[model samples]
Target: MNTTDIIGTIGVSLILIAYFLNIFSLIKKDGNLFYILNIFGGAIACFSSYLIRFWPFVILEGTWAVISVVALLKSIKKPQD
Candidate 1:
């Protein structure tokens, strides 16, 4: 596979894994790991999409990455129980 394809695959895999973990109750939705996976995955996916000149996915993934980053920051600011 090409570099872009490989990158997109890995990015999508990371995102899907996070979703699967959440659905299976293996990880909390608000957990740092979940946001981390989403941020990285979304950023990678956004890059790949931009490389391909796919505006729709670029927007989608960009938004996803931004939201994940915000969530990550919020999680970090929260005091531990």
Candidate 2:
């Protein structure tokens, strides 16, 4: 309805889309696109939470974003075949 809600909905939509695709075998869990979706989604969600001064979700989504980044990095460093 408002800016916060709109932003949060978009962020959540991205995350859900990624999950749904993964569940349907449309996207690989370990693939870059999966991680990218999580990274951006978590970041946008975290930002919305910050704008609303919601510390709990700010912490949660911030952690999610950070963890996704770490995962992406690890995947990138894997020895190529």
Candidate 3:
């Protein structure tokens, strides 16, 4: 596989691990850093797919990444539960 493929694979793997970590509380739900990292990593992975010229992945990841970051930001501005 090419370098792009490897990089994208690593990025995707990180996103999945982060997602499951968040889901299982392996990372604390209230941790801002964790959330930011998750969003950032996911965005990077998704965006990389776009950079590689994959239209469908670009759309899927683009939408999800934006939504994740926006929601996280909004949550930050509001008081915690």
Number of the top TM-score candidate: 2
Candidate 3 lands at a TM-score of 0.74
Candidate closer to the true structure by lDDT (higher is better), 1 or 2 = 1
lDDT of 2 by residue, 1-81 (tens): 999999998888888988999999999999989999999999999999999999999999999889999999999999878
TM-score of each: 0.95, 0.96, 0.74
Best by lDDT: 1
Clashes within 3 Å, all models in order: 0, 0, 0
lDDT of 3 by residue, 1-81 (tens): 887777677767766777788898888665665667667666777768877899888777667667778767877899866
Model 2 residue runs over 4 Å out of place are none
Clashes of 1: 0
lDDT of 1 by residue, 15-70 (tens): 99999999999999999999999999999999999999999999999899999999
- 1 or 3, greater by lDDT: 1
Best-to-worst order by lDDT is 1, 2, 3
